[model samples]
Target: MNTAAYFAQIYREPDPFQYRQRWYEARKRALTLACLPRQRYRNAWELGCSNGVLSAALAERCDALLGTDLSAAALADAASSTAAFANVRFEQAHHPQDWPTGQFDLIVVSEVGYYLSAPDLSEMATRLRTSLADDGLLLACHWVHPFAEALSSAAEVHEALAGGLVEAFTYRDADLVMQGWGVSPTSVAACEGLR
Candidate 1:
């Protein structure tokens, strides 16, 4: 099955990944948010936003946020989930191919990279670097264990996405791996003039 169909099938369950209920999911989201180097972003885009659980949280920190997913069902759920957020918008997009035209100060790739083939991931990395604002940041998080549907390992996905970007930080556990990348190599303390 293709990625869209696979996701569409699973999304029929509304909260297929239990992103809203699982403690692991909540903790991961919190960690992702806390790891961000800045308190606010002018513009942000979340690739494969799923049901907008994380998108809504991100909306709180961004002036404008765009969430994209390949599944219409997922987008519908995302819109409903983030209905109160005027700064958030949802769209249907197949990454690296249906990419948006503008740059974003924050681009999030979460739980979606492993679905792409190697070539697609490479193209995505290149596009991500170019689409990022000069001082922008890129964050990617994914499951570490092998899964039947995943086309690539989490390591491969992160490596491809890390191309042309400086490592910011990484968090890993048995279940997941999360990393942040950006143009500058500075730490949060350095950015805050504490270093």
Candidate 2:
């Protein structure tokens, strides 16, 4: 089945994903949030924000946050859940092709990379390169287990971003893996006192 269909099926009845009750997901989200380079961000974008649980957490640190998902049902749930946060917005968007314009100080890819084909993920990374602002941060959190529709493994997706960017942080557990990257120039400077 296609990525959209597969996700639609999950959203139709997401108990199997167990995003809320599972300790694995909670731990991964915590790890993802901890690895961020900055304590606060001006603008943040989270693609494939499955029900907006993490998006709500991201809203606390971001001045403006946009969370997108392909499933309408998911978006509805997200909107209702995050209604109190005026800075948080939810939309229905697909990746690589339907990406929103403008630069973001923080970009998050959580549990979404495996849906795309290798080439598509590469293109998404390229787009991320251009869309990300200087000193911006990118966080990728993915499940470590195998799935039938996944085009690439979590390691491969993390590896694709290595050559072009600098790895800032990483957290791995039995259920999830998280990686953080900062673009060149400011990358090393941020490590030193230059920035």
Best by TM-score: 1
Query: What tens digits encode model 1's per-residue C-alpha lDDT throughout 1-195?
Result: 488788878988989999999999999999999989999999999999999999999999999999999999989989988999999998899987898989999999999898989999899989999999988999999999998998989999999988878998999998999998988784778778997
Cα error, residue 47 of model 1, in Å, equals 0.4
Off by over 4 Å in 2: 14-16, 184-195
When summed lDDT is taken over every stretch of 10 residues in candidate 1, the lowest stretch is 183-192
Error of 2 at 55 (Å): 0.4
Give each model's whole-structure lDDT: 0.92, 0.83
> What residue pairs are clashing in model 1?
none
Candidate 2 local Cα displacement, residue 190, angstroms = 7.3
Model 2 per-residue lDDT tens digits across residues 30-138? 8778777677899999988888888888999999999989988888888876888999988798888898878998999987878878898898888888888877988
Question: Model 1, which residues run further than 4 Å from truth?
Answer: none
Q: Which residue pairs show collisions in model 2?
A: none
TM-score of each: 0.97, 0.90
Range of the 10 consecutive residues with the lowest summed lDDT in candidate 2: 184-193
